[model samples]
Target chain A: MTWTVIGTYATAICLLIGSAFVMVGTIGLVKLKDSMTRLHAPTKVGTVGVGAVLAASIIHNFTFGYGSYHEVLIMAFLFVTAPVSANFIAKVNIHERECDTPPKPTVDEHWATLKPNGIEKMPDQPAQPSNGG
Target chain B: MIDLFNLPVGDGPGATFLAWSVAISFAVVVISQILAMVRVAVGPGSGDRILALDTMVVNAIALIVLLGISQGTSIYFEASLIIAMLGFVSTVALARFILRGDIIE
Candidate 1:
């Protein structure tokens, strides 16, 4: 009985927390001004929002149903892929000129995404020796 | 209200609290989904739209997990997982298409 009470309350708390984070992240996505700045918002949904809800599901399952760890697979997948997708989106923003251009690299003339033409040659290839070795 | 789902309101006040909290979270998640849809509709750039869509996908996963909890079932887990995978793949594909004008190259 005591365990049931602990589990139920914990699950409820997790659900509420997850819902709050999801709300905040969506609000950020809608309200933020710039494209690059807006990119910063929805990541919370990918991380804490869905994460907390999945945690709630795991707790609820253990307490009230047959326990299973499959939800962890979903959680792990989300954690692993969130940053990759975010990076891709940022790259799209840069390529499309939707966001501010990043500062010039000290060594390179252009950011790789902003390079003219389609990857024609490697940047700054060392000169081959005129004399054959 | 707690009796709506007919969930097992275990022999304590916590059970009722749990049921109510789940209901509230369901409503909250739905609201967030709508907000994300709004972003998708009016976003100034394609990047914002893609980001909004990604947020919507994550929100959908949250909604599915809540449904599983409220209904006391684990079956929705697979549905949410598949959605998560599809969401990531679609987001990356869309971004890649915009970046290179080709998804496979």
Candidate 2:
């Protein structure tokens, strides 16, 4: 049982754990209802699953001296982008139903960016009479 | 059969443990994917379907990364990147469709 062997074993175990998390996330996707709930499934899985796999790769690379942390950069990119993408899609979906208009072409500008914090704006609603009429 | 880069099958920690771990993880992923498939198939609305697809894509990317680790190859990393890029595109497209009823519009 050399150090090299032990390192590989650790990396392999990490990879497996990461993979298992991903699978659970997918199961959640199947069990949950609506687009919002489904969107949540991937976020939970992608973060930890990608993290574990990348960690495993880092360990393997360190032990074997194969590649640099370049793959890690990819993992980082995924971590940042996956959730944003999910949120974008979910937002657009919500807006479409509320507006009864076509979904906006750009979710970032039309839905995510413009959406007020906590308070929802209904475009079709008329203003209340200040005079109590 | 110990190599500087890779742990030789027998020399390092016996292939049995390594193989079993990979197998178990692989099984878990498969089962999860199956469950996702059920959701995708049974979802009541288009939005639910799209969400399921997104989750499926993420799971697929995870599987690829794990495979890369098991095989000790960088090929799977590239595939994982492609999947990541493509997943975003498909999700955006689907979301657009959900809103506008068309991808381009």
Candidate 3:
């Protein structure tokens, strides 16, 4: 009976904390200005919010003899993919000129300043038109 | 006797507290989903909408996990796993489309 009580408190507290994190992430999404700023919120969802809940799941499962580490797999997958997806989104934003002007460099042209030519060459390289046709 | 798999529902505050906490988690997940939708609808740029869409996916996964807990079943785990994979792929695809105007090279 005592162990059950401890487990319950642990799980409940974990769930409450997890839900709070999720709330913060979503509120940030709705309230933040600028596309760049908005990108940070979902990342929080991927990290703190989802992670806390999964911890609760792990704890809850222990009480039921469902001692499985499947949650670890889910966590690993999310951690790996969240960054990749965020990177892609940032890249798209840069390509689309959706972000604000970046800080200027004194010696060289900043990558953000370059206008990415569609269906063309590398991002940091100059556009080279073919003379073969 | 330990069932080694039975839920710990002794004459304690375990079950009741878990139930209430899960309910609260559900409410939070729903509110997050709504906020994500608002961002999607009013987002100024394609990138913002893409971010919002990804947030929604993560929020949905959390909800699925909560559902699994309330029902005391582990089956819902599979669905959340799949969603995680699909969410990443779709977000990348959409962002690629926006960046290059084409998905394939």
Fnat per candidate: 0.91, 0.54, 0.82
Highest TM-score against the true fold, candidate = 1
Best candidate per lDDT, number?
Answer: 1
| CAPRI level of candidate 3 | medium
Give the clashing pairs for model 2: A103-B99, A103-B100
Candidates in order, TM-scores: namely: 0.90, 0.73, 0.84
Task: Give the alpha carbon lDDT tens digit for every residue of A1-133 in model 3.
Answer: 5665777788889999999999999999999987788888777789888998998888778875575878888888999988889899888777667786566668655564244544333334446554331
Q: For model 3, how does the per-residue alpha-carbon lDDT over B1-105 read when each residue is reduced to its tens digit?
A: 332224344546556667778888999999999999999999988888999999999999999988777766778889999999999889989988877667887
The best candidate by DockQ is: 1
Tell me the tens digit of each residue's lDDT in model 1 across A1-133: 5878889999999999998999888899999888888889888888899999999999999999898889899989999999999898888789778877889789967787876444554456546233321
In model 3, which runs have C-alpha deviations exceeding 4 angstroms?
A103-133, B1-11
What DockQ does candidate 3 have relative to the true complex?
A: 0.62
lDDT of model number 1? 0.87
Ranking by TM-score: 1, 3, 2
lDDT of 3 at B14: 58
Q: Against the hidden true structure, what lDDT does model 3 obtain?
A: 0.81
Q: Model 3: how far is A130 from its true place, Å?
A: 13
In candidate 2, how many Å is residue A56 off? 1.6
Q: What level of docking quality does candidate 2 show? A: acceptable
